[model samples]
Target: MPEVKSQVDPSDASPFTRVRQLAQRAGLDGFLLALLGAILLAYLWPHFGSDDGPLPLNQIANYGVSIIFFFYGLRLSPEKLKAGLSNWRLHLVVQTTTFLVFPLLLIAARPFFDTGNQKLLWLGGFYLAALPSTVSSSVVMVSIAGGNLPAAIFNASISSLLGVFVTPIWMALYLPNGGHNSSLWGTIGNLALQVLLPVVVGVLLHRWLSAWAKRYDKQTRYLDQSIILLIVYTSFCESFYRGIFQGYQLTSILLLGVLLLALFFGVYAWILLVSKVLGFEKGDTITALFCGSKKSLVQGTVMSKVLFPDARLAGIVLLPLMMYHALQILIASIIAQAIGRRAAPEVPVPEPVAGT
Candidate 1:
């Protein structure tokens, strides 16, 4: 019989194919592409979802944010948190790095951005530092790196809960009095209503709904991302309308990106050193590296809505976080892959069989 020939379509050899191949090689996959697309679309059509626009996007996004946290609560496993609580030392280090060390580092950089809008930009950086470690990504990266998965989940979950209270207190120190529609106590109350209440309810229902939540996890994530994108779009629209981004030079934006990258690596290195100094095991060190280094875009976006009611300032505040989010995912993914490769179990050599 003649050997079978393989079929290859000419369309498969197109330039689009080559571009996709190159993108994959460089790790710029669909999610990153979608993020870029969202920004560009926000920039080009800022009016589409503006406060005075055709649709009530802001209101919808506000509700969506609450739902996102609700699902987050639903998905969290109390058993996992209980199991991981034994690692008190590791938890202390991760949380300290997140809320304390990260802020101090950004505060130290304040002298550099002491100019006009640069100060606001610095505030953005400070807010990013004050935010919590990402739950999903931190756990994902830790698992990928053969780390203590339970501890990662515990720290990330606890970090989010802590941020609901801690982040606003930190911001209150800097944010102008009466910038919000409500007083500090009122703001916290509102946040509790919108974010914390849903979370509490979801957690209460988790025993019954966890399996359902697990089944629809991907859809939940998609909803979260969509809500985030809507928030971003509305934020930029407000910024564009008020000319908040106009004063910012392109170089300034680029510098912010560079600074965010440096901040990520700097924190990562500090965490790694601390892990070593504290005599953490390899797995625990990996958990610290991932959990201590990450800042949650989810928490940042949701909290920003409640924290900064000033729409114009919200976009500026979110800028550093947005950049950090992208950079962290890119850098952490590469690092996780490297760590995973090192931790992978070696294949056992097969013994030659007597029959062979």
Candidate 2:
């Protein structure tokens, strides 16, 4: 007789598979986890990423930032960005919410947080508000939720481009609130080098590099994440080396987490109400909520090095954005999945009949 064998259920998977499944269910992005790992690495080994360290990570980060934006420009579709422009009302709502209401919410909450240590965290929140909407993630979420894909693409792309201007201006206005009049305009000239110039070059080269961008999209994405990790690591390394986090307590971080959650829900709820008031259809509403409510971590990390005069400031100043980025992705994912499921057309079950 052949040896009898027991079959394992698919549910009983390897530890790694189970963990991955759990992560999917919870809508966790690996990039967010990698960010935590980068911070941990920074804390554990600040010396390697120090300004005077052997690797010259600062120079590497500077160069890497340009490359990331270059790839961004290479992949951007000028036609697709223009396709959704007919819906001026939707565009108005999305852009207004992103550039206006988002910041106002932070300003409304300002009085509660402008004290000593809290002031820094509040400044971080304002920076997050000032940053523009994300691109890929916004489009991805809107697509999943059965939203207006064209408008999603348009608003998200425009937001990123606008951020190259709007964010710095907003920061310049708010930096004074923290009693540090860091000349964000002076930084804008630097931005034109690392941020704008590369974007312009990439756009000019788009006809040639577009195909390459499509073919190696995944590889380019990994490069983007790697550069981001490097930036985070290096910035935090400088901060830790200089003892910038010394004044911050565990409670302060916990409070920041609470505030970030509130901000996410706060903006989300506000947009949902506005979309309804504006009589937007389901698709446009979803686009408005996801696109308008998001803050770009890519822009945040890329701009941080230039925005803050002190390398040490980048680490703390980035806390609110990193937190909000992780939070929005998580919450938006869950909401999108639920909405997708609800909107899915139900297939009819077959009824047994005369055959019997």
Best by lDDT: 1
Task: After superposing candidate 1 on the true structure, give the runs of residues whose Cα lies further than 4 Å from its correct spot.
Answer: 1-27, 345-356
TM-score of each model, in listed order: 0.90, 0.91
- What tens-digit string does per-residue lDDT give for candidate 1 at 251-290? 9999999999999999999998999999999999999999
lDDT tens per residue, model 2, 1-356: 99989998868899998887567555565777788999999999988887867888988898998998898888778888778779998888878888888788889989998667788788888888988888887887787778998998899888888888888888887664342436766767777888888888888898888998999998988899899989999998988888878888999898889888998888888888988998999999999988888888888898887777567777888888888887787788778777776887352211101000
Q: Cα deviation in Å at residue 145, candidate 1? A: 1.3
Best by TM-score, which number? 2
lDDT of each: 0.82, 0.81
Question: What is candidate 2's local distance difference test score?
Answer: 0.81
TM-score (C-alpha, index-matched) for candidate 1: 0.90
